[model samples]
Structures are given as C-alpha cells and as structure tokens.
Target: MGRKTEQTMRTYHRYLGFFLAGIMAMYAISGIVLIFRNTDYLKKDVQVEKKLEPQLTVANLGKAIHKKNLKVEKEEGGLIYFETGTYNTITGEAQYLEKRLPLILDKMTKIHKANSDHPLFFLNIFFGLSLLFFVVSAFWMFRPNTPIFKKGLYFTLGGVLLTLILLFV
Candidate 1:
C-alpha cells in the first residue's frame, strides 16, 4: 500500500503489457481464424498423394496418412475409402483432398494451440502466467479505497459475469 510499491507495480504492468502486445495480437487473430477452421474460409484444397509401405490396414492407413478419427465408409477390393479420399492397400498409395490454410496462418494456429509435445508449450505456460500477472498487477495500480478502483471492481465483475454467460451459452 506504500507509494513506492504501487509505482513499481505500475511500471512492471506497463512494460509487460507493451512487451506482450505483439503476441496478444497474434493470439487474437489466430483465435478468429480458428473459429472458421471447420469451414473452407481462407483455405485452399489440394490433391495430396502419398506412397507408403504396402498392405497397411485401415487403422494403419489412417496412421500413415496422419488422419484422426478416420471413418472407413466402405472398403471394396484393394481400396480403402474414407470421407476425404481413398487408399490402396496393395499399392500403398493414398490420394486425398486436403484443405490447408496459408503457411503463415497455419503456423499461427499451431502456435496458438500448442500442446505438451511442442517446444512452444513452455512459452505458452510463460505467456499464460504473464497474463495472470497482468490481471493481478492491475489491482495494484490503484489503492482499494479509491473511487476509481471501486468502479474498476464493478467493471471487472461485469466482465466475469459476461464470461460465465458465454461459457454456458
């Protein structure tokens, strides 16, 4: 509650906010793009052909093609059929239609959705903790008894309420 402590908190908050601005913008843009991922918006379809080891089973074919939740609609003779394309068991050939975002956009989305396997997972943890620090540092910007801080508390509560509403709906 001392004057020097408040000043230090504000300084850290200000600089950290500036330092994270670029990454924050990237996440915002990536989030918006991901909302349209199910659709072909800003995406291009390409005919992809792959040649793997022959005689792969349906599960193995899915693994070879790097597809998840692959459904084998129908299998006839040597060909395995799926929603996007076909695989030949005897030939170890795969031909499929693949929808892809532009290279930079694709990288952005991948960074946004970093998993534990990715090197960026540690960066994600740091970024998440930094964001939490920003939230806590905001309270230190003003003393609790001030009118402005009281008003900020109301605004914060409103934001929390809105988030809860969005979560259920």
Candidate 2:
C-alpha cells in the first residue's frame, strides 16, 4: 500500500488499541476465569430461599427449585429434605445453598454471554468489528518490503496454525 494508506491504518490501529485496552484486559481475565468453570475455583455458596407453587409433585418440585437429581433424602411432616437444604411440600417454601462467582467476576464473565436482549450486545458487536479492523490494520504497521513485516507474517502463520490445531485436536 501507499505511504498515506499505511500511515492512516497505523493511526487507527494505535488509537483504537489504546481505547480498547481495558476491555481487552477484562475479556482476557474473564476468559481465564471461564476455563475453571467446571469446578468451584473462585465461587462461594449462598443460602437461597424461594416460595414456589404449593402442592407440587416430586417431579415438579425439582423443576420449580431448579435443581437436578432432586433426590429426596427424606420426606416427613409435609417437608422434603435434600442435599443442599429442605423444601416445604405443603406451602412450597424451598431453601437451598447455591454456589456463585463473586459479583465483580460474575459481571465481567457476563460480557461475553451478552445476547441481543442485553445492552452489552452492542458493545460486543463493536468490539468484534474493531478486532477485525485491528487484524487488517496490523498489516499496515510495517511495509511489506521490510524484514520485520516478513517476520510478522511468519509469526502470524504460526499463530493461525496453533489455533487451528488447538481447535480441532
């Protein structure tokens, strides 16, 4: 590309990189946190209580309480007991303990999960498009004839290859 195009691309790349630095760091941290989701790596249990529909059946009770397995340790005197807590079969008062990530990390991790209904959905779209722009603009950071540009191409190829291997293998 011409000098003007290269300079323009570099300007956009540099300024946009600076502007998105904080969000990028958050995305990175959230991604790392998600890797440990299968376990309670950074989570805590909190007591939860909810009043559900009364007189629910054994099956419906689990659905209402939003628990899997729904094992009834014992039911006595219109109450059902389970691993986490107990439930009132007559009045539908359920108490349980739920594990949750802390507030700040929870909110951070939610950014990637934002759907069309979320306000951050627009931010997701904008960040994604800006990332595409960054990829294209990176080529303009150095002239194609330069040694560093050639080395960058090699590194880019290695990165793409490593990603593909990790994705499919």
Candidate 3:
C-alpha cells in the first residue's frame, strides 16, 4: 500500500480505538453476562408497575407486558393472578415482581441484544463497522516485511483456528 494510505489508516485506527474503548469494554462485559443469562446470577426480584391497554384478555396480557408463556393462574374479584404478579382488569395497571440484573447491567444487556425495532440497532451497526475497520486497518500499522507484523500474522492465524475449533466443538 501507498505510504499516504498506510498513514491515513494508522491515524484513523488510533483515533477510533481511543473513541470506542469504553463501548468495547461495555460489549465485552455485557457479552459475558449474556452467557450466564439462563442462570440467576447477579439478579434480584423487583416489583414493576406498568400501565397497559385497558380491558386486555388473559391471552393478550403476556404480549402487553412483554412476557412469554404468561397465563392467568386464577382470578379473584377484579385482579388476575399470574405466576409473577397480578393485573387489575378494571384498570390498565399491571404489577409484577421479576428477577433481573441491576439497572445498569440490564440496560447494557438490552443494548447488547438490540434488534431492528430498537434505536440501538443503529449503534450496533456502527460498532460492527468500526470493529471491521479495526481488523483491516491493523494490517497497515506495520509493514508486512517486519518481524512484528510476521508475529502478528501468526497470532491472527491462531485466533482464527481457535474460533473454528470452538465453533465445531
């Protein structure tokens, strides 16, 4: 590559690395948390109150509250009881006790799992592109003939091999 192109890559890579350091840390932490999501690690049960659409049926209550497999276990007077909490049919109020990670960790996990329906999806795309740029620009950081660059290639190959092994095993 041209000297100018290599210089540009190095400059942008350095600045982007500095800019994205915090977000990268967040992704790493959140990713680790998600691996143990099936367990109750770092979780506490808290009461949550939500105002949903009024006069919802038991079948639709789960969708409104964003829970799955939720059913009304019983009904007494104006309240519908479920495994986690109760909903007042007369009003649009739902009160549930749910186990969740702490607020900040929960928010981080939400960002980590953002979909197309969420605004954080754009951030996901940007972060993915930034990571791709980092991978490519790293090659420009050192000349291909250097010992450091040769050692880096060996490390990169090892990483790729490890990833493939984990994928199949």
Candidate 4:
C-alpha cells in the first residue's frame, strides 16, 4: 500500500475510535444494566400513601393506586386501576411504592431502548456501524505478514466461529 493511503486509513481509524469511546462506554454500562432489567439495582423506591373518603368504587380504587387523576380505561376485580388517577377509597389507607430511575442515565437508557422509528435509532445504527468499522480497521492497523496481525486474525476467526456455533446450537 502507498504511504499516504495507509496514513489516511490510520488517521480515520484513530479519530473514529476517539469519537466513539465515551458513547461505547455508555452502551456497555447500559447494556449490562438491561441484562438485569427485572432487578431493582438501578431504581429508587418511593413509598406513597393516600387517604380516601369515598365508598370505594373500582374507578376510585384505581385512582388511589395511581396517585393521579386518570380516566378509567378498564375495570377488573372489585378494585379499579386507571391509566393514571388519584382516588380515595375506604380501605383503611392505601399505600404503594413507585420505582423511579435516576434522571440523566434514565434519559440515555430510554434512548438506548428506542425503536427504529425513534430519532435516536439512527444514531444507534451509526454507532453500531462505527463499532463494525473499529473491528475491521483493526486489521489494517498492522501489516498482513506481522506476527501481531496474524495472531489477531486467529483470535477474530475464533470469535466468529464461537458466535456461529452459539447461534446454531
């Protein structure tokens, strides 16, 4: 390869790596957190209690649970739960705990969970392509005949084989 082309490839790989490092770290952390999604590790619990004076209609019961004013979407059981509502029913005192994620990371986490139509989805796809570039660029980082390059090739092949086996099996 010519000196200028090789140098340009190196610069492209280097700058892309630098640009993506922080976002990569964010993905790694959030991905780990998502793997344990059902757990309470990242959520803070807030206990809420409300008093009711009404004679406990299903709609009223649901409103109490939701702690907001909401239209009764559907009613099941003798109790009522609206999409969002606040109500007072004669059940001694109704209380529940609300789980809330931390503010800033929560926004990032939402973006991470976004679907294809979401604005962040394009950014996510770009990030994934950047990762693919990082992996491919790694090969050009070294000359083909170099020992390091050969070892890296073997490792990459092994990784691909392992993934294929896992997928098929």
On TM-score, the candidate that comes out on top is 2
Greater TM-score among 1 and 4 belongs to 1
Task: Assess each prediction's global lDDT (C-alpha) against the native.
Answer: 0.92, 0.91, 0.93, 0.71
Higher-lDDT candidate of 2 and 3: 3
Q: What is the C-alpha RMSD of each candidate to the true structure, in Å?
A: 2.1, 1.9, 2.3, 7.0
Q: Mind sharing the TM-score for model 3?
A: 0.83
lDDT of model 2 at position 36: 93
TM-score: the better of candidates 1 and 2: 2
For model 1, how does the per-residue alpha-carbon lDDT over 74-134 read when each residue is reduced to its tens digit? 9899898999999888888899998999998999999999999998699999999999999
What is the per-residue lDDT of model 2 for residues 58-123, given as tens digits with 9 covering 90 to 100? 789888877777888998999888889988978889999987899989999988678899976999
Give model 3's clash tally. Answer: 0
Name every residue pair that clashes in candidate 4: 52-88, 62-80, 62-81, 63-87, 68-85, 68-86, 70-85
- With a 3 Å backbone cut-off (N, CA, C), the pairs that clash in candidate 1 are none
lDDT of 3 by residue, 1-169 (tens): 9889989999999999999999999999999999999899999998899998778888799988878889778998889999999999888799999889999999999999999999659999999999999999999999889999999999999999999999999
CA shift of 8, model 1, Å: 0.9
Best-to-worst ranking by TM-score: 2, 1, 3, 4
Which model scores highest in lDDT?
3
Candidate 3 versus truth, CA RMSD in Å, comes to 2.3
Decoy 1 TM-score against native: 0.87
Each prediction's TM-score against the native? 0.87, 0.89, 0.83, 0.67
lDDT of 2 at 2: 96
Cα deviation of 160 in candidate 3 (Å)?
A: 1.4
Alpha-carbon runs more than 4 Å astray in model 3 = 53-55, 76-78, 90-92
